[model samples]
Target: MACRSCRRQLALLMRQTTTATEFQNVAILRQFVATRPPRLDQRRNFGSTPRQLGVRDIIAQVFKNSAEPYRVVQATEHIYKACAREASYTISAKDRTAGTIPKTAEGEDLGEGTTMWHNEFKLPPTFSTWSQVTMLHMYLIFARLRDLDREVARSWQRQLIDHYFFDAEEKMDLVHGISSRGLRHRYLKDLFIQWRGIIAAYDEGVVKGDSVLASAVWRNVYKARDDVDVRALAAIVSWMRLCLKMLDQIPDESLYFQTESVFKWPAKNEFMLVDKPVRELEDALQPTVTSAPAKAPVKVAAKATA
Candidate 1:
């Protein structure tokens, strides 16, 4: 057997070794944790250091004070381009022809004289339709920007409108075959006037109620036609309200960095006006009732016999 002193030294050495091993394990664990990727919900600071900043980012920051404004401009231009493309997309001839007439099982005419304007019921792919839709999206952004600094908001608004009109002018030249610069300028001027009018009319309607807003949409989009479909009008108004509500919920930073397809118009089936449940409001207004105390039973005195 080893002497008592020797056994004590061994025990001490073992304890030291175990302690050192534990420390090493802890250090390894700390390094692993430090290098681990961030969670999906967590936001990482892309501009935390100079090394993290890209050339454009650095330029934007140096010149514009913050890269956010430049990003907003880029995002707005992207949105306008997307809207322009959407507006210019023409309905396929086959689909248009199929929609105009109802046919039997053998492709025979069913003698139904009524023509189906299926494209009109939803968002149509035309310049006028695109303009209205693009304006609506721009309005939502403007609405959000109302809370921003006046100068900053004005700058963003100017850039956004400028990009839109520029794209519009290009579309007019290439797609619509308006090659004359003078004519394109005149058309752009008219469109700007219309845009201003739309903003004023729509703002008034939003302040009043949905009916008023629907009327404005009808007048602007349908050109105040007597035979305008009420369902289509209602759908457009509902879609506008939904889009505004969604934009309102998104943070400004997130909105500025949102993807190109983020502002896509809702599909026919998804077009809905989501409102808070009536029961929820009623519950909020009413107070909760607790159980009442049991009333003592009163014994009726027996009637005196006469």
Candidate 2:
């Protein structure tokens, strides 16, 4: 009998082997036969592609040093994975990639080793007011843990807040409200603040270099308002304000801010107008932040939880 055939028989016999020494020999032979030969012996060629991981992509995955915990860390990771899977289908559907892994500038296969969320919503169709709102809340939590560009984060945040208000009102069908007049004016007033803040952020260079957030926010905003009624828009803005308040109340120690920092005072002078409203909202929404034994800011920073 051939050596290979003999080995197979031995392996089969080992399964039923009752004698200890015989079983041991059979098992050893079976392992030898089943073991894969080295690549040179197999004579097969192999290659792998490489790419650069973006700063945002890395930050998105890391939850260490965050004021928040790992559960929120897990959620961000889950979202990224979900988005990545969606990106694969969407990119293929749009013919952006030809049934292969996409790469960033560094030639590393961009989507392969990374989480899904970054790739999937990198562009529209996946982008929406709801997504923007959800992500901003995540971002705010993250911001408290890290030092990011305060103005840029704030500008995008303001836009997302405005968008959610209008969106929430429309969803609830509370456009006319129980009192139609009170609804419209306050809603409109909030919308005006959001719109003007976003515009002013652009004018004042708050979003000067934040192309990614700026472009995405504006695209979603425009998509939400193609020939829609002015009142519908105002209602959307009001609804968004309520969401912003809720999001603001999300504890800094929550999992979402694991590696991020919430903007206490983003931008030098940008807070001048928004501070009052932010303070009022915060007073209503934020829990009393217990003092931590009056430690120095550096000392506080040192033992801070993520």
The numbered model that scores best in lDDT is: 1
TM-score of each: 0.56, 0.23
TM-score, structure 1 vs. true = 0.56
Model 2, residue 239: displacement in angstroms?
A: 2.5
Q: What is candidate 2's lDDT per residue for 134-232, written digit by digit as tens?
A: 433433333332333464244323333333443334422331122465665675566556545454443333234433334334444434334443333
For model 1, residues 1-306, the per-residue Cα lDDT tens digits are: 996446533543443344333454455546544654546666667656333444345344344433444455567667656544533444334544555534444442233111112264543345666677677667767776776777657656766787787677766765555789999999899999999998898998889998999899888866677888776777667766766776667776665655334456552433333323445688899999899999999999999999
The models' CA-based lDDT, in order, is: 0.62, 0.37
Model 2, stretches more than 4 Å misplaced?
1-72, 78-220, 223-226, 255-306
Model 1 ranges off by over 4 Å:
1-69, 90-125, 259-267, 270-306
